[model samples]
Target: MKTNRHSLMAKGIMVLLSLLILIFIITFAWFTPPEERNDAHGVSMKTKAGSDFEYAIGFKTSQTFGEYLVTDFTNSEDSEWDIEDLHVPGKMKDDQITPVSYNLLYDYQPIDITGDGYTLIRPAMDYGNWKINTGSFDYSIAEANTQYISFDLILRSKAATTLSLGPNSYAIGASEVEGTTAKPDGSKLTGADVERKSDYGNFSRDAIVGAVRVAFLGFDDTLTAESYSTGTQDDKLNHTPSLLWVPRPDLYLNNNGNDLSTSGWSLNTGVTSGTTFNLQSQAMNDAAYSTYRHQYYNVFEMTNPNDTVEVATDNSDYVHVSAKDTEGNEYHLNDSVELISLDKPMTVQENNEDVTYYYGKVRVRIWVEGTDSESRRALSKGKFKFSFDLTTNG
Candidate 1:
């Protein structure tokens, strides 16, 4: 009789355990949205970040000839950056700045002719250019809220080296990288939507990536004072300091389907008419290399503007495709691109160092090109990565 009772008690315990497991499964399934599910249906975006925009500078794990670093203006010995894991990259606190893990900052709002999206603004540079006066505290390194996102990097080489900078293609979740399907007029996609297996969305744009420009500003001769220059062949690149443009080709808008998504003027050359709204075609590759400076566009309007843009003089509801840089330099954003520098010097800092290897600082400025035809309000949701490759040009 005791044995039978013991068996009955064991059975009861098993039943309780099973019930608890079932409850957990039901609760999880009921509360979790498809987008947040752990399954591979919608969540694995092949990126370390989940924000509207994700970025990284990666090199193959096999290449270890020289030392490469992503660091900030911190005085700590461990100032080296961890790019693969999403870490707080110069998060701006009213009182202090520290590296912590957090949600990434989204795109700037109300994009206009006078907005931050219009040009390559460099507020940070090596030798402590990014440091600012806190008033209450000593000068501290800070990042702009909307103006731009800059990264500090150091690359080491024995001598002058020419690096190969290439871009990666993008793809939606479990979808082919055919291309984006959303039209420039902020309309829904037609051939790449995951739900319909056709119609790709605005989450990624090809021309958007092409319009991005990265320049190796030059090498640094100082490490504690303010300095900036667009030096000639004497300064294309070399040891201790440089500037680069980290491209976010997969950048998307936060509120894509809202009324605001359909309200902006499509980039220049979009299919539009006087005060009448129409959807733009799939894409317009307005990212052409400027043999001669494309005069900054001047938007023309016929009273109420629609989802179209054109040069001034003609009576149409469109905008001219030109903007002023941070320094009041007028040039179309599409025309303001510079390729990465070649054979820059490298910097080295060791108490008893050898002349074989050298190190240099590189400041990467990442932002969306505001004048690209794909910069419409509707195409907002995408992920892309960067490939930083360097090889001798011998």
Candidate 2:
């Protein structure tokens, strides 16, 4: 009887252990994560799968002055890719100013793959040799990732003076090298093309220079050669006197002591009938006068009337002027003067007075430093325009 009981207990323990093992197997089969699941066969199995492959690129629509000029490209595919080559095609309007020089800033320094930075990537003639070969460095775009390429558009001071006030467009192209793919229409990837425009909407003729008028204060004809030399004479002398004097006849205007005035004096219109002058129409407030008074007078003298002259308070009097956009952002005049000067042009709408104002009007001032005839002839007068095209590839 004892032997029979022992056998029965041992059999029951084996049955219970089998039932636990079965429950564990069932639970694991139902609750296992998808990545860890086995095949239908009771044996463990593994498999690899992926989706349809693709590739693409895109750019930002607009950019403002003083802001970083960023050009970005995106890759939309599972495969890694690289930019084989890039080309930027640009052109200017037939009558617009030609771009002489440009300096581009890169996020990463360009490597000397071929020992010549110019041959690889540099500003050349209008759309001639502006192509860049970027294969040396690891300029890679990971699966479904995006990369940004930026440039700080810099122009020679002389170049910015000639930039036209309108839209300038460039054709930019980028070619894929590593993994050339096809489009939805089944065409292979030759290259991608995009259009970019540097719009100078705020720097228009209507905005910079408005209606203009001129008035010449006549010469004081009362002085003789003898009286001119004598310090006792208080007579107003016209033009530069034969001899040097402290209070000599120079171009002077009534600015309520602002010293802002137009060009030379004349009986009829100031200087000439068609001659235009840019004068500070209003008086400088105490704050502006205290801060920028010296700059105001200095720029007023150096700047030519009617013609677009860049003026800056920081640089030398002869240095090219910087400009502000409609948003009041400052930029080099050579790059583009799409905005007004910080000195501010006067508007008739605000002042409501005639008196042949100069602030907002398209005009320039004239002043003879000495008796030099050539210096007087250096005054420039006319309307100016500039246009150009630019292209980039990466």
Candidate 3:
């Protein structure tokens, strides 16, 4: 009877494993699998003239888009993916992005007029330059939601290795030419101007550069690399899929671009060159900047804040991770994660270049963590040129 019971338990575990694998396969099938990324030097890919645009993204109608891959993400159209691998390891866009994006988010004035060497990052709101009294954070700025950048893509691994991602060779700067024809005296607002606009769609990459987060939907954060991939289908389905990220690169002041920098930022900001006024009070209001204290709204605690480092929005109260838990609560694993799928290896041939790789559907997100310390101080109008490096230890 004991042997029979043991046999029963073994069978149960096997069935469970089988179910998990089935679900994993279905999940990938539900979402398109990773395929070849191609280029045509400006020649139509359909024509095969070998003229692939350096890089392309978004709708086919988009001027900035290159007809690299014929898959239309937003429209859910059939991808023109062939049953071949381009035999290339991986390559990035070679040319600079033409005409980088621009915006009227900020017309920054030097804080030295009031006395200071730092900038303030306000809440996701619009407040007209409300020059408030020293140490007052509760001024006229309206409260609102913050803007962040995000995208999703499939990572085809070549081996069953542990994976980690990092921003490689990425830099963003603002433009020199400031002020728009419309708001020339130059229009700027505080909490009253643009407090966290609820519309997530309207935002600029002119955000804190370092506060980036990655989510591998195929795995669970709480579980080990082995179990997480088999954990649940809910984690994959709960969050919305983002369009493949394709940046429109360009030049700017530091880089001038159209991203909003919260208004009345100077109000709470307290980066002064002295020890005169209330240090404790400024700290309370959260604009504390002096020899004695340093705290900024944008510093989301992705890292510990001490003498030398100022991690963006280090506090979770400010950082926002959109994924939710099984109980539907916001899941806050707010950092990039290791992506481990199956060891099942496959090979493909494209343009007669055969390649071997594993499949891992990955969701990648990047944004200026508004809660980061450097966010407010970051250039408002700029271009962010980004690339990702996926490495592994099998």
Best by lDDT: 1
Angstrom error of the Cα, residue 11, model 3: value is 59
Give the runs in model 2 whose Cα sits over 4 Å from its true position: 1-70, 73-280, 285-394
lDDT, residue 68, model 3: 19
Over 4 Å off, model 3: 1-148, 166-284, 287-337, 341-357, 373-378
Candidate 2 local Cα displacement, residue 169, angstroms: 13
Tens-digit lDDT track for model 2 on 209-315?
Answer: 00111111112444332222111212132232111111101111112322222222111111211232233322112222111111211222342432221222322
Candidate ranking under TM-score, highest first, comes to 1, 3, 2
- Local distance difference test, per candidate? 0.25, 0.16, 0.24
Model 3 CA RMSD to the hidden true structure, in angstroms: 21.4
Ranking by lDDT: 1, 3, 2
Candidate 2, residue 16: CA error in Å?
92
lDDT of 1 by residue, 1-394 (tens): 0001100000001000010000000011111211321211101112112211111221111111222222222222222223322343343455656543321122112111211222332211112221111111121222222233333333334444433332211112211122323122212222243322211232332223323333343344443112221111122234321223322222222222232223322222212212222222221112221211111122211344332332122111111222223342212222222222323442334477633333333444444333332333233232222223222222
How far out, in Å, is residue 9 in model 1?
70
Collision count of model 1: 29
Error of 1 at 315 (Å): 27
In order of appearance, the predictions have TM-scores of 0.35, 0.14, 0.31
Q: Answer with 1 or 2, whichever has the higher lDDT.
A: 1
